[model samples]
Target: MTYKGNQTTWDKLSPSLQQKIDTDLSGIRQTVTNNKTEVTEHLAKIATTENLGHIKPDGKTIKVDPATGIASAVASTSYYVEARQTAGTTTYDVNIPDVTAYKPGLTILLKLLENNKQGAASLNINGMGVKSFIFQTYAAAVQNAGELQGGRVYQLVYDGLYFTVIGVQWVSSYEGGTDLANNPYILPSYGAVGKVDAKVAALQTQVDSKSTKDVYTINIPLISGWQGLAQITREDNNMLTLYLDIYGGTRTGGTKIGTIPAGYRPVQTYSMYFGVVTTASGSVSPQGAVISIYGSGDIYITSSNIQHNIFIASSFK
Candidate 1:
């Protein structure tokens, strides 16, 4: 390139100085030409990996630091190889058109033609022998059936010995207390999974058999000249109460007014703390008798006494 400044001062110089300037200009031009030749030669040898274009005199892709040009090292992402399972179940027979031999980190897009039916599975790619497959990094964990579901696309990397899957949508062998053997796909993220039971929508499963607003049907024995009403109500608190007034004549101890259903019965004779009684004359005194409900669901006076109205509510297991 020519010098970027004007040569106006050259004409005003003494003849001898002008001669010197010309001589120096000639030498600079020669130097620049020689430098260009050396640079051109140096660049030609920098690199010429065609796939990454050669280091011509202009900007170009350079692959001098990896694979072919350099010593063993991680290569660029492998060529896209489409693999599809052709047959076999536990050990799938795969066809990866571009794969002839296994290479470390050789990743491929695999399409499963059949779902695996065993906890362990392997893939034999193009007769290259079987390579263990996994949906996760745990090589020791049971692969479990349906782990590699069919009709699904998965990315996998060949780690020399095994093909580690990039993963498909699965719950995994561990984690999630949910029972999904019947259905593995997740429900749409909307309402509670699988329409919730209306009775339990606002509560958890009452495994202890506790209930809300549980009314017990008691068998009342009809007594002459006795206007008695018995109503037992349980609020799931393991306690029963009388919500209606009970009027009865003097009955001896062990007289069964009624029996509660099996679920409402106690394990043993349970004395109720709220079975307070009053005489039909509406007199509240020591003349009243206490009631005890037995495991047989028998409800009766704990001891002999005149028929007293049980002004009731009870706390018992």
Candidate 2:
């Protein structure tokens, strides 16, 4: 018989039933208090623990200082092994306690301190089960036990099968952008502008040299780009044919510059003839012209001299 809110109903209940209800209430109160005390004890242990060994998501255990609530992973052990070939120590074997202890993404940095040895030194990584480890000074395609140089820092990471080289320090060169202060690499400056200026200067010099013209003798080859006048005098001629071979001018055989007949020879004494030669025209073939006289004429053709004057232009077409 449970107790009701009404005092009349409670009074109607048997004393034995009422005593049972009171006993049940006392047990519930004690259980609640015990649960609160257990919770407080667990919280206190969490707050007081100096080193909280918590497993990280990567399966590595991190130690947390409960007083500061700062969590930190265990640092990798650095081995500064001295390898000198002069001392007959060509290879240094690194002994890792357990190969299975290494997980993927685990990194270890090792420094190889050389002792000014005469020959090269190498490192042999041991204790990693069937897995092979490759060490190199720079990134390479092949895997091998690389030669160890003095004062070089190498970073190695395990990929569950092989310990691959991911980074290196004290290298001679780097491929990508790096800090200019300590790195040996240099950035290239703009050089195309300087090259263009040099080319333009050379072209200007050529143009300047092409602007002068000079006179030449027609008997010799004519110049490439000039036109000149020549005077030919024939004092005595018996169907004389004079070849006017300009340097770069042309004319047909029938093209006559002057003609003298036998009847007018002694009477005239001398006959003057003038002709023009130019290297600028495209109609001229074979780059020359001929002056001839034919008429059964005994005439003296003379003009200052047999060789005529020709001028050559400075500029080329």
Candidate 3:
């Protein structure tokens, strides 16, 4: 029944409209015979507006508008996308389907494919323009090259401005030596979390099964006449160490020293040649010495001249 004026009597109103008042407004969904409680019962479920969320949207958060005092369900993007390798290193582009709107507090997880070169780095998430990373955990930290590494995940949060990098995972460049001391954003590994003293330290564990990591130091075996020791350790990310100080044997050039064993060899390749130069007074010259480590666990010391008590530890390409 259509109302012609603002004033209407109980008997004049149609039964259908009164029932609509019960179902849509009062939430009774039945014809009301009694008109005594009409005013009081009509106010039931007054807040049930079409703007309010009824259906549960998965990965969405219900928030209240401070200005209008109305609640709404918005896309939160509370999950992460699979690791994406950015085509560009300095400017990364990752496509996450769930990221539709660029609002404040919207966070995104990025898995990088290559090391971010030094200078500055930015992210273009879902083609949402380039946003430079204003990385900050404690103080204002400038973006450094190689800080955001490949095969690792990082979180970026929008603050109505630049996305701030508030977290950092372990710098897991096993054979590639990237230490954690420079990375002040170190946190616990694996899925479990402990009490973190700093906010940055609490965010490192995520998106990888590689939770266990360490440096291995194995002593290389020597022949009967060889007396000194040779130790190979994991030093830097993508780099291995081979330090040896052996003497007392009549060393032959281009000859086998001994096997370094299977587990002790570098994991990068089966066989690798390291043109190492060692300084040995009088016997072996640093210029002519060549070290060859085979994947078959054989280490050969090839030097035209012999040496004793040689200590060699320097940079290698």
Instruction: Report lDDT (CA) for all predictions.
Output: 0.60, 0.43, 0.57
Residue 30 lDDT in candidate 3: 39
Provide the global lDDT of candidate 3 against the true structure: 0.57
Looking at model 3, which ten-residue stretch has the lowest summed lDDT? 190-199
TM-score of 3: 0.34
Going through the candidates in order, what is the number of backbone clashes in each? 4, 14, 9
Which candidate ranks first by TM-score, i.e. highest? Answer: 1
Q: After superposing candidate 2 on the true structure, give the runs of residues whose Cα lies further than 4 Å from its correct spot.
A: 1-91, 98-102, 115-123, 127-148, 169-317
Task: lDDT for model 2, please.
Answer: 0.43
**In candidate 3, what are the lDDT values of residues 1-317, reduced to their tens digit?**
23344445755778987676545644333335455366455444233444343223453334334332423235355546444335545677767777776777777776666555666667677787977777565324335464677677777787776778766433322332445578778643422222233434544443243445555677877874676877777643534577777777556665676776655565532323233435455343436555666666576656544444445553222
Ranking by TM-score: 1, 3, 2
Q: Taking the tens digit of each residue's C-alpha lDDT, what string does model 2 give over 178-253?
A: 5556765754223544566789999998878864532222222222332344322232332222333232222332
TM-score of each: 0.37, 0.27, 0.34
Q: Is candidate 1 or candidate 3 better by lDDT?
A: 1
Which residue runs does candidate 1 get wrong by more than 4 Å? 1-33, 44-47, 50-66, 69-89, 141-144, 168-317
Off by over 4 Å in 3: 1-31, 35-44, 49-75, 82-89, 138-144, 168-317
- Per residue, candidate 1 scores C-alpha lDDT tens digits across 1-317 of 23343568656667987677778899999999999998887676565444333465565435555435433335435444434444444566666676678878777676665555665666777888978775554654326364667777777777888877775433433334555675678443223342344446545555346544555555444343335676555545566554335675546766666666666666677764443456567765564566777788777767654454556655556
Model 2: how far residue 305 lies from native, Å: 43
The full ranking of all candidates by lDDT, starting with the best, is 1, 3, 2
